[model samples]
Target chain A: MTAPARTTSAAMLDEIRFDAAGLVPVIAQQHDSGEILMMAWMNRDAVAETLATGRVCYWSRSRAALWRKGETSSQVQRLIELRLDCDGDTLLALVDQTGVACHTGRRSCFFRAARDGDWQVIAAVETPPDELYGDR
Target chain B: MTAPARTTSAAMLDEIRFDAAGLVPVIAQQHDSGEILMMAWMNRDAVAETLATGRVCYWSRSRAALWRKGETSSQVQRLIELRLDCDGDTLLALVDQTGVACHTGRRSCFFRAARDGDWQVIAAVETPPDELYGDR
Candidate 1:
């Protein structure tokens, strides 16, 4: 599908009911496959930049700044669509993900399944973690 | 698919990495169709309770208490499998959802899709808000 329309960041930003911390939770999913890649936080600026650039941006709680996905890992997520829930407190970004979405080198961050009364690693690491973050 | 193994709520709870507020974000999804329902927060007690009992429970930030899904609306979500992301900060609960998941009576809270530079309602409300929250 075509990417979400641009030129409406201001209108879109107004609809988001950001939390007291000025951040909102965002879920990123693989656009074509419908597979959820990861969950992250986005502030007003991050959301605006993503809509402005068609590239996913998030708020790094640790860095306290804008976080562009794949900035260091080269696992960029190109925004295909952006969605807001009924409450406007949450967002869903449909994106075209490159390589693995997990820092652990897994296709997605959700690789561990609760099974047999414990956590089980259900998915294998597609790429080595060292290779993904070798520069860092 | 069969439901996930139970009998280890304590062990499961230990793996969760809740935030400073003692809560973690949980995404609920339709297990059979792979459709995302909604996102909610869960505390340690809520997570344990969900595993102990097959029902999904959330930490209501507003109510400052346990919020059971469908407690009033009867749109329950039965846990099919729970997965933890690689970071242990977020969770994915695959569930067999009954009735509607959104308070607005939409099957999913993600009914609004960004299209043509604005939000578009893609999914119609399956049930009316009055009927869902009438008892309240």
Candidate 2:
């Protein structure tokens, strides 16, 4: 199936009704498999950069800077398509994910489930955390 | 099929790794229909209250207070099951939703699609926005 093309930065950014913090919640999903990989915060600048470069960029609330996905880790997310939810409050990013999307080297950040009152890992790490981050 | 039982509030809350803002993003999905409804923020207290009462409660970022689901709009979301993501940074609430979930009275907040480089409303509002938030 062919992916939908992204809109111009001007039109796309205008559609987003950013919060007072100038941020929106973004969900990264694997394009072909329909697997949700991770959720992160994205500021206006990050969203613009992602559209311009096709590399998913996020705002690290902790670091307070533009986070180019896989800048340090090799689990890059190549933007295939970008979507804005109806209210224009959240973003859905379809991407061609590299090795892994989780900091833990797992395929996704949503690998755990609260089952029977206990947390269980439903998915395993594709690469070791140490190798993916590599001291950063 | 019966719903999965919820864990004790004490045990479940301990598993959430709230961000520096003491907030976690919660995704509400229609239990039987599997329809993604809306996403909201939740604090520890809201999480505990929701679990204890079986009413999906959330923290209003704008109001900075507890937001009881359907407090005014009659769009209550009753908890069916709650899942904690692998990183413990996000939560998924399988809920039995009553009435509309979006402020716009659409069945979901994700009603927009970025089609052909333009934004389009993919889903129609089931109820008008005015009646949903009446006098509030």
Candidate 3:
């Protein structure tokens, strides 16, 4: 979905409070089900790119560069809405996910639940990791 | 609600990967409505306490102390389920929130939506900050 008219990406960026690492934690939630899919980091450039391209982009700490979601797996996330928290330190991106959102191929990264003193795997992997990234 | 049978809190603790600051980011989501309320940091002690007591607790970065939710505002959050991401770096606490969860008195911290390139205040503050912490 298109961002409603008036505000510009630059103005939106000015409102966020990025951390010392120039990054803000972003949580991606399913637009329809409200299921939280994943949490990632985004830099100013990543946020601007997501807003500009309508595709979610994150700053990969490991790679130390821009990591577009599903770049390898093709499980792209289309931005439905981008939300900034009251404190401007965090973000919530309401998105339309194409497929699974976890590297493990689970629909969500939060597939493990604390139960009876231990974590129980509550959701099964929808696709195997090797399969998702095999061609790459 | 109580944590289910078998696994112990200790085992659960071992599964987590705290940051260099000895903190893990925790996202509190409304159990029934599936609405995301807020995001905060939780130290090992905070996690242990929340699992032990079933009441949400966070590590206040600013105050550098254990922050019990609603301790000041009485907007307590009762833990329904604690979830861990595959990376073991973040947490998702499914909670039954008593009242507003935002310090700004909004139901959620995410009250600002990106619209037409600008941040729009979509939700009104339910209770003024002064009123929520007036007694303190």
The 0-to-1 C-alpha lDDT of every candidate, in the order given, reads 0.89, 0.81, 0.91
Which of the two, 1 or 2, has more TM-score? 1
Docking level of model 1: medium
Candidate 2 on B3-72: residue-level lDDT in tens? 4235554766888999789999997878776666778899998887887678899999889999998989
Candidate 1, residue A7: lDDT:
62
Find the candidate with the highest DockQ and give its number.
1
TM-scores of the first chain across all predictions?
0.93, 0.91, 0.93
Off by over 4 Å in 3: A1-7, B1-7
- Tens digits of per-residue lDDT, candidate 3, B10-119, equal 76898999999999999999998889999999999899888888899999999999999999999999888999999999999999998899999999999999887689
TM-scores of the candidates are 0.93, 0.77, 0.94
| All candidates in order of DockQ, best leading | 1, 3, 2
Candidate achieving higher DockQ, 1 or 3:
1
Tens digits of per-residue lDDT, candidate 2, A22-73, equal: 9999878788876668889999988878876778999998899999999898
Quote the chain B TM-score of every prediction: 0.93, 0.91, 0.92
- lDDT by residue (A22-109, candidate 1, tens digit) is 9999999887777888999999998888887888999999999999999888999998888999999999998999999998999999
Residues A31-136, model 3: lDDT tens digits: 9998999999999989988887788999999999999998899999998899999899999999999989999999999999988768899999999999889965
